[model samples]
Target: MTAEPNFVLDLTLALGTSAMGGYIAHRLKQPALLGYLLTGLIIGPFGFGLQTDVEQIQALAEVGIAFLLFALGVEFSLTELKRVRAIALQGSVLQIGLTTLLVASVSLLSGSAQTPLQGIFLGLVLSLSSTAVVLKTLTERGETSTVHGQVMLGLLIAQDLALGLMLALLPVLNQPDAVGLALGLALLKILGFLAGAIALGRWVVPRLIQHIAATESSELFLLTVVALCLGVAWVTSKLGLSIAMGAFVAGLMISEIDYADQALGKILPLRDTFACLFFASIGMLIDPTLILNNLSTILELVALIMVGKALVILPIVLGFGYSLNTAVKTSFGLNQIGEFSFVLALGGLEMGLITEQRYTLLLGTIAISLMLTPLWIALAPRVVDGLHRLPMLKDILNRAEEPKLLSVPSDLSDHVIVAGYGRVGEVLVNVLLSRGYSVLVVDNSETAVQRLRNRHVPLVPIPFVYGDADNELVLEKTRLETAKALAITLPDPATTRLVLQRALAKAPHLDIIARSHTNEEIDVLTQLGAREVVQPEFEAALELGSHLLNTLGEPPFDIQAVLTRIRDDRYRTIRPVAQVGEA
Candidate 1:
């Protein structure tokens, strides 16, 4: 092996381009992957080609996909799938098949460079927007448990499995025998690979990780975890399967481990960097000029991608016993192009199943489709409402709807507000509700609020207003005058301050419990009139400590519950300091 270079230019370009993409994407409410794709587009063969070190950079970028999907596999579980089986399988299959038929037909008619079979591949790809991107967006916004989000995750998982299968099929699609043989071999390899990985995870990796954790070298721990994933992936690839399968299996194997969350947290930042690179690489594949010249194709493709797919999916979801509106929204969510399309296209090219022109067309189409998902999702309600009123869709809408009668009891007293509804604050809500305390939920979540509203659950069921909790008006609407106290259950300190300030002014006597994202937030929230502070990772750490102590045969056996009790901590008395300035 050669010695490592003092400075890697390609690495520099990857980092630089990724940073640029990330910053820009952050500003645009888009995924960094989009930026990465743009980076690749800017510096790709068409753009700068800047070939001083293209090969090494491309290789580095590819690892982003592996690491990203590996982590993604951990996020998904068969258990979760079973829990959401109704949406995951039914919604996904409906979305994929419908999107495929519509997109393929339109592509063939629109004179796309791709063949009909390639169009099918393109549609399948289009149906799979990046789960990594969407999930991160949802998580950051604290909407994972939201109905549409859950539906989105279910559909994404289906797409992921499809992408994996596409990987198996793409490299052998032209050869019928190879297709059957390779796919069969791939399936068997994946199954065995998963079994082997689980065995290692259940019996070997945990002990190894425990030993490594004891060493307390984070660098070492991260390296070891990375090694495990890469090692397993390599073994699978060597066994005649795609490395992508190995990556996903690696994540699944460790998903159930005791330190799985910790392991994931440590690797997450690094995973994001490479993931951005992966998206940039995808962007590099697009030809902006070609896209500009192909406006008609793009328009037709986008319409087919969204309209035809939605038409097919809405009916299927309705058939499966969901209401038309819910089905329509669900269909809208799946109407984007995914990262899988790029992978599939590459696979086709490698297998001589597709031409370069067709691959480019697919890439551009997928990119355009993906670019539209957030916008589309944002506009779903209006579109669904309009569609419901349509003469054609109205009957379908009436046939089976998700359920209506938002009995929003208008008679609720103002109460303290908590933004996030995660586990940490669920207990708080329970305590408040059980004690006959009327608390107004200031959550922006569409589904959670909808659930609480549907049940007419506490305080005569006031509507749970939907929007960013950090906004001043969201707090204002919560009726701080009637509010007895306020709680900022969100982890972000800056956001906490926005809520805390409004609370102090509106109801000075209000007892506020604010969540902290950092240690500094403890001091900051104290200054901001937060009567108490909660940190997500801090809570998790306490749990881990208790878990560790019990595992080591400590005297007390009730470690977990004991850790959950915050009575010992001066959480109530922790007066928030000024939102800014020094201690």
Candidate 2:
């Protein structure tokens, strides 16, 4: 008897290829999502043709998209969502509206969009900026706490919230004859879903999670979570909306529960696996011959998508009262078309609102834009600096005023400047104050400053400067030139290097001691002119060794001598030696 093949082998092959591609992309210092896409391209029907069941692969890919949105909803905390509500909601709406109006006009005039529906769909797709790419890049650079980073995050969150609404309205837009009625009906359905979701979230979902969590079986809990996500998604699909919307709502319901973190931890791996497949499926849709024949069009579209969006967003950010540097960085970070655009594009194609050729072009252009996102983010700081040097833009750049978030004594001098109010910073602040030295804290977190103000510590009043330590304006307020030493407690190497470099430039003789997390960072920080670079892990090891020696009745003098030797040798003496194993 002959045996029939199953889809399991197909699934394994897809994941294996994606893993290999992701590894290669990592080695090349690129985003892994790009690798996944390339992998799909290679194995897809249009390429090497390894996978025969394209329909099955695509069906899984849809589930992947749902999980991706679900993960996004879970990570977005209500506190964070509420904090950026004004700018996120209003700024995003304005940005989307303006970008859509302009893009639609351009499409109509160019004859690319034969009907208003196609133009509107085009506008909507282009209006969304990639949240995953921007967030990943910012987190890697450790800029998530910076003003520009916060603004970008807020805007991305707003875009995510608006995604469901956009998905619902897209189908209605396809119906030109009953556009108004369809739109109204869609809105009502969405509203009903929201109301029902809120009620479930408040009354039922939390208790359901509690019961599932009480089982204490990780496997069962995971199964239940998946079921919830899919169940809500199925409900939305029945109501003529996207499964992604339902998944997002399911996530929101769980987010307020105590088990949210555990749920996130359990689901993240699955979400990532599926998300990789989703990107791969997108790559599979690309026809290389089509791209080869329309290379110029692809290049032109990429330019419009990346450059046009950036130019549009820059003014929007600036108008929101952010500085030019912040505005520039935020704009560049969000310039690329988003992952959700793929969903919308797929919807448009299914409805015949766009041709397959146009869909391929969008995929190609979006890929190019996403690939360029990291480079654009890297250039933002330098671009801001260059613009400040130009006589024309200098005035605008200099117009940024210092925020009145903190008060520092005007006569402060010979104090220590602590650049961060995290655990280390707080410790440094207390020690400095106890030793009768005036300390100034430079932290970007407003919440940290508020906590400091409310603290009931016995030490004398500590002056705080609330802003990014890397900003020269903030550094100047710290009286860096007069300060005896600068203690950088910030854990981010990028921020640490920037602050160290800027402080040296401001005052050549300023003594700076910075924290580092890696040997490479230690070297980098030291080269950047930090007087002392302390790696926490090494220090902890040293403390442990000292305690063990004391317990063993080793002479205190001997212990001190060994510790002094290690410190004097810059930890070279205590650094672990590499061992060779017998073959």
Candidate 3:
């Protein structure tokens, strides 16, 4: 019998190893991509030599890249992007230009590149940050809606959008004399593709998707979406453009349709499966012996990338007029080289812009930087605290202009102080005003404060403080001594806890009510001296249960008693219990 192909066996090994690696990374509080990379390293040529069909695996990995960018395009939200358009557009462009310039200068000085074009290529490779890792980290930490989180995401979105142009521009860098001609051709091709995509999105996609949905067959819908994604990617490859770029455009076509959410939902499983292979393939390219031989050099490079990138981003955010705390946090969160940089580096390698050894170094550096991103973000608060303690830095970091007061009486007493103006705070403030209660709002978000200012309304003119509620100076401005109660509704648990502690410190007998974002936060906030803690999800459940009982013809008093009992016991009966030896 003829020897059988090893493709199936290789794929199985790759998937199994990646799954176990991902699980371990999750348990250890790291991004699953880190585990996938480690798995690839182990089973690859440099590791145990388990994978025999590396070429086939890499070909499938290309599909993963296509699907990954496709999903991103489908999930793209114009509304959210609009919220931070200034930073997302102008800020990201500035950041990319500055980072590339700095890296090129350094590469030339160190004699790492033979020519200016090669140096520029090297700079481009390192300029992008990993969106997958940073976003997953932000979601895990419950900071997605925080100011720094929003800013990081906005910058990341812009970077990802810029990748398509970067891919097109890389080829032009390979040509020296025909640079302008090559660039013009690239732009023309991109414009032609975009026009075709827009035309499809505007007319064809909606009708096509609607008809597909009318079939009411899940399998058929999924197959259609997959075909569309692959077909566009194939076309782009034929046009001498990146397949990933075509896939993204295909996704944008789907995004404009009413079935965008359903399409995304159907394609997610396939995207994730293929995306795993892509990350694994990247890992397979890393050589362990090379890394071991140059361990110190790799570590040094990782540090330089993280610190240098952070320093570059810090002032850019500060220049945009965000607070020092926000700027610092955003910088820390995005200091590492991103996953998309691998795509650019691979393109460079293929175009002969960089050598094999240099490609290996870039891969290793990117991996290490991504692995450290989560830990770096976790340390940001502590870094901010240290900065705040330094006498020279304190004033500068804390210098926020006070918000203009609106129609405030000199004798403002026996009123409530609301520490946040988010969804919960907004409603609470409206209710308090409706009930003729004097209210003072304290918020850190410049956008939120600006919105509050623009509400020229039927409601009473509100007084507000434009600074972090956790800061003592901000609390002092809230007239804590004369306030009837304090409501802590900040989305960040750490900030909420700090606000509660600081408010109580200023007025020992203040009746402070705090909001809990997680189950564990309830006990922590109570222990920190909150008079009452409210878990929004739990409260919603209680309301639903009470309504169900009343609908069954039960007495109102009886329903009230049941809810009261649960609340009186601090939700001990309904809260989730920890399993044995659970972390």
Candidate 1 least-lDDT 10 residues? 400-409
For model 2, give the RMSD to the true fold.
4.7
Worst 10 residues of 3 by lDDT: 400-409
Q: Which runs in model 2 stand beyond 4 Å of their true positions?
A: 1-6, 62-75, 115-117, 136-147, 174-215, 225-261, 349-352, 389-396, 401-406, 421-437, 444-462, 489-493, 515-519, 532-583
Q: Candidate 3, residues 1-583: lDDT per residue as tens digits?
A: 7545688789989999999999998789677877888899899998999999888999998888778767766865444445677988799988888888998899889988888888888877787887666765775577877778878978986776577667767767756677777667766877797799888878988898899899999999999999999999898877766676678678878776689999999888887788778778878877788888888989999998899999999999988877677888999999999877877889889999889988888888987887788889988977977887799977765555333333345788998999889889999998988798888888877667777887744654577887777766667778899999999988777678778877888899999999988777788888889888999999999999999999999999999999999988778788877611131
In candidate 3 the C-alpha lDDT for residue 134 amounts to 73
Tens-digit lDDT string for candidate 2 (1-583): 5433647777888899999999998778677777887898899889998888777888887787667657656766565456556778799998898888888999999999998768878999999987666765775565765667778878876676577677767766745676677667767887898899989989998998899899899998999889888888888887777676688778888887899999889888887888778768767876687778888999899888788888889999878766666788888999899877888999899989899988988988887777678779978888876886789866655546354577687888898989989778888888877787877888866557886787644654578887767777778888888999999998556567878998999999999999986655766788789899887888999999999999999999999999888876667666656211110
Predict model 2's lDDT versus the native.
0.80
lDDT of 1 by residue, 466-495 (tens): 544544444556666766677777533344
Winner by lDDT between candidate 2 and candidate 1: 2
Better of 2 and 3 by lDDT: 3
Off by over 4 Å in 1: 1-7, 24-34, 73-81, 104-127, 139-145, 170-183, 235-245, 310-333, 349-355, 377-422, 433-583
- What is the lDDT, from 0 to 100, of the residue 162 in candidate 3? 71
CA error at residue 310 for candidate 3, angstroms: 0.6
Indicate the TM-score of model 3: 0.83
The best candidate by TM-score is 3
